[model samples]
Target: MPAKDKMDKTKMVTCTAPVNIAVIKYWGKRNEELILPINSSLSVTLHQDQLKTTTTVAVSRSFQDDRIWLNGKEEDIAHPRLQSCLREIRRLARKRRNDGAAGLDSTGLSHKVHICSVNNFPTAAGLASSAAGFACLVYTLAQVFGVEGELSGIARQGSGSACRSMYGGFVQWIMGNTDDGKDSLAQQVEPETHWPELQILVLVASAERKPVGSTSGMQTSVQTSCLLKHRAESVVPGRMVEMIEAVRKKDFPAFAELTMKDSNQFHATCLDTYPPIFYLNRVSQQVINLVHRYNRHYGETRVAYTFDAGPNAVIFTLRQHVSEFVHVVQHFFPPETNGGDFIKGLPVNHTALSEELKQGIGLEPMPKGVSYIISTKVGPGPCVVEDPSQHLLASDGLPKECV
Candidate 1:
């Protein structure tokens, strides 16, 4: 093959992005295309070692069409939400090309993206898999196209909460008022370096998939739940201010109060929906009650608990208190439904677990299939990695190690 002919082959770029957990949750969207949230939300981006996705995107002449391989499996590229993100990034890259000497070669800028992503944890583990996936997708694309501008804007199209994942540590997704959703993007409140002592404990109630997805669940809540209207109109506005201040001061009690309240309200809104969607399972409820009782007994809030669109609970505690929290919760995880039988059973989700959790913490082994846990902390925003060969796609723009 001639040198020019060989150079006609496609090129690839690989990037990795971390997952994030919202302190101020984004439950609904005002604009689907732009992924404009109904209200602003706040989150703590986790360290990459704890929970993250590594995605490699490639663009090449040898590829036939846009395709995706999620965790080594081919998935249809038909979701409008996913496509909206990719489309926006491509549009921006092309716009940059129109300006001379933007540094990106015109030929490379025009290449179609073929993305392949894999999470370090189980996608079925009831964690925020999509959050990491979409965030990584947009972050990686920005690297491939060499686009200029704040990446948070691009991540918004992928997932409203994902904008926060573009940065690590403390982040806020500002709900911009513009009709185009240009100003409604994420911003860094503080870097991880500022609060290096914060800790997160994921209490995996059940590894099973969530009963309802956040997108559809939020839509149902919006249409049927009057309480949701009240939250959007009344509650979140004030809580947002409070949460920000709490983070700035490193005030755990204030942060815990606001987080617990916000989570309860979110769940309540889910219940308010007609034919009400139930995201929390019995085990989940048990966990909540246990946390509430622990706080009451301690006479102060040492830890905060929140749930996304799943039964699994994500707990936020100061690094100083993490050991105590873990010690107390560990006893609640018994290996069997009851003693001596040794038959593995799921963790008890009964409402009467207040006494059990307090007295039983660390005494029992976690019940079989009862839980999976990941301990992690706040992380930094998205970054541009220089190596394109690290991506999941091969030189030919096909997924590496596909089934």
Candidate 2:
């Protein structure tokens, strides 16, 4: 006889959401339930180019149980963050149904959501995977269930930064004063079309993988790192103002300065942690030096760099400087001489593609082929796409039983 199985036996409902990158990072939280941050953070909406997660969330009575397939692999739905979002969304959904807002045509849509997410890039490689995943998950769920009212408010309960991911271009996560977190949500400051001249070049650092996850690392820092207090109180508030003004004015010099400084300070706090979590590897460090030298050599700031939970670099520059930035980053990673023997899931370093690894260690001119480069720019905020087939899960709002 076949082994017994356990899961909700029902059909499924489906939807998808894009990822986003922050200009002013969301580092810590104030309210966990409402997913409110201690301070306001801003972000540039990353274009859905090479890096993004396509999540199809489904719900239905035919489904056996709640399930998620991220990048084609089934993931445990036991994480507290995941659990909280699901519970909250479900509660809101029931309210909507009882309120008669649920569309009569789709009666089973609100019951269950089977989420299937595929990240175009490596998830563990640390390019803000959770930000994209949670944002997409929440956005898609709201759409599938026909639940309404301020989508960002719901997304916030998923992750502090996730709210910003709901929109593209310049976004602000308002640090609202509501104790219930009802007022704390993300709003679009500007659309991607407002900054067409800005360009982003992502530098893939060591594919070796991150040593510390952001959630755990942040918790550790919050508990032990004293500098974090100063950062939260004094540093970020001023930097947020300057960064916003710089974006508004398109001031490269000021933008670069604040970005690099904030990044360095964030990393410094990481070092201040008792266990000392190292997110940036030697390659990431070299890229930092390389960017510094590029700006110095040019006699002005032409580019800016920001890092998320991982060491991979997101370089911001005007369209005018993108060719120069791309040329410099691309030469850092070329194909290995063995020709096509490269491995997936393994971290790729700037030096691995470089001919001379030792000499390429510092701020020296980047060797050709040391790194892989992707060119994208800011994008717009979240919008609900009406087509159901676009969703990842079954029409019944569940993952296909086969998957």
| Top model number, TM-score | 1
Report lDDT (CA) for all predictions. 0.76, 0.69
Please report, as a residue range, the 10-residue window in candidate 1 with the lowest summed lDDT.
342-351
Compose the digit string of candidate 2's lDDT tens values, residues 1-403.
3322223443334444456777676776666556677677878888775456677765556667788887766889877888887777777777876777735334554454567877777676767777777887887666666666777877777667778888878888888888998888888877788778887877766554678877677778878888887888888888888888987887778877887788888788889888887888766787787788667766788888887778788888887777645545554444343323322221233333333432343344434323455567776555555676665666455445454
Evaluate model 1: give its lDDT: 0.76
Instruction: Score candidate 1 by TM-score against the native.
Output: 0.89
